[model samples]
Target: MTAPVDIERARFNMIEQQIRPWDVLDLDVLGLLNEVKREEFVPPAHKALAFVDMEIPLLPDTDEALKNGHCMLPPKVEARLLQDLAPKAHEKVLEVGAGSGYMAALLASRAQRVITLELHPELARMARENLQQAGIRNVEVREADGSKGLAAEGPFDAILLSGSVHEVPQALLQQLKVGGRLAAIVGDLPVMRATFVTRTGEAGWETRQPWDIAAPRLAGFPEASRFHF
Candidate 1:
C-alpha cells in the first residue's frame, strides 16, 4: 500500500519551489496559501494532485464537456494572480470563474466581500458547497455566464478573471470602480500574456502586460473574428 502523502511538506514545497519563485512574494498572499487547504477544495479523486504544478480537473473524466477538462488553475498561477490584484480588507472583488471556490476562498480572506461567477451549473454548486463547508461567509457564487461580468453588482474594487480569454471584455472593464485593478490572461495559445488593467477615470483605463502565461479558454466570452485567407 502507498504511504500517506505528507500534506504539509508538499504544501511547503509548492510554495517555496513553485509560487515564491514565480514572484508571489506578498506576505498576505503567501500566508493565505498556508491557511487555506487546497486539498479541501479539490475533487476526491484529485485530492493528491492538489499541490502539483498543473491544473486539477473539477469534473469527472467521462463527462463529455470535460474532454479537455474544466479545471482549477495551477497553484502558482492562482497565487500570482491573487498577488497581482492585491484585494484589500475593505475592497469588494469579482472573480469571473468559480471552479471549486478555492480562488474565492483566497480572495475572501483578504477582501471584505467577493462575488464569484461560474458559468457551469455543476461547478457553481460545487463552489457554493465548498465555500459553505469551509465556513467562508463573504463569498457569493452565482450560476450564470460570467463572460459579461456582474453589472448589476457593479463597481467592484478589484476584478480577476480566473481563466484565460481572447481579450478582456469592455463590459468587465466598465464595471470596475476608478482606481480598481483587473487581472486576466489574454490572447491565444502559445503566446498569451497576463494583462492587468486599471480604471483611471470615468472613461479612461491603463493596461500592462507583465508576463506570459497560457491557460484553457474560458467559454461564453465573445470570440474575435478572423478571416481565412
Candidate 2:
C-alpha cells in the first residue's frame, strides 16, 4: 500500500520532471495540477500510474479499454493543452472527450462552465460520478458524439479535443465564437501535431501547430478514405 507522502512525492516529481520539461510553464496550470487529485479519477487498479507520463487506460477490463476510447492523456499533454488554451474565469469551455472527467475538472477550475461530451454511455456515467466525487460542480457530461460540436451550446469560448483526430471537423469549427480558440491533436499515427485554431472573423480563422505528440484517435470522427488512382 502506498502512503500519503509517497503519492505526494510522485505527484511533485511528475510536475517537476514530466510537465515542466514539456514547457508547461503557466503557474496557474501548474498549481491546478497539484490541487486536483488525478489518482481519484484514475481506475483503482491503475492508481499507481496516475502521475506517469503516458496514457493510462481508464477501463479496468483491458479488452474493452482503448476500443472504447477510455484513456487519460499523459499528464504533461493535458497540462500543456490547458496552458495554451488559457481558459478564463468567465469563459464557457467545451471538451470533446470525457474519459475520466479529469480534463473537464481541470477546465472547470479555470472556466465559468464546461460541457464535456462522451460517446460511450458507460464512460459518460463514470465521468459524471467521478466529477461528483471530486466535488466539481460546473462541469456537465453529455453522452453524445462529439464529432460535430454541440450546436445548441454554440459559440463556446474555447474548445478542446481530448484526443487526436485526422483533421479538425468543420462542424466543430463552426461552433466556435469569433475569437474563440480550439485546441486539438491532428494527424495520423506515429506523428501528430497539437494545433490551435482561432476564429479571427466571420469567415476567417487562424491555425498554429505548436508541438507534436501522438494520441489515440477520438471516436466518431470521420476517417480519410482510400482512393485508387
lDDT of each: 0.90, 0.93
Candidate 2 per-residue lDDT, tens place, 122-208, comes to 789989999999999999999999998899989899999999999999999999999999999999878899999999998899999
Q: Give the Cα error of residue 196 in candidate 1, in Å.
A: 0.5
Candidate 1 C-alpha lDDT tens digits along 6-93: 9889999999999999999998899999999898899999898999999888988635534333788999999999998889999999
Q: What is the C-alpha RMSD of each candidate to the true structure, in Å?
A: 2.7, 1.7
How many Å off is the CA of 207 in candidate 2? 0.3
| Top candidate (TM-score) | 2
C-alpha lDDT of residue 132 in model 2: 100
**Pairs of residues at least 3 apart in sequence or in different chains that clash in candidate 1:** none
Tell me the TM-score of each prediction against the true structure.
Answer: 0.95, 0.97
Candidate topping lDDT: 2
- What's model 1's lDDT at 70? 72
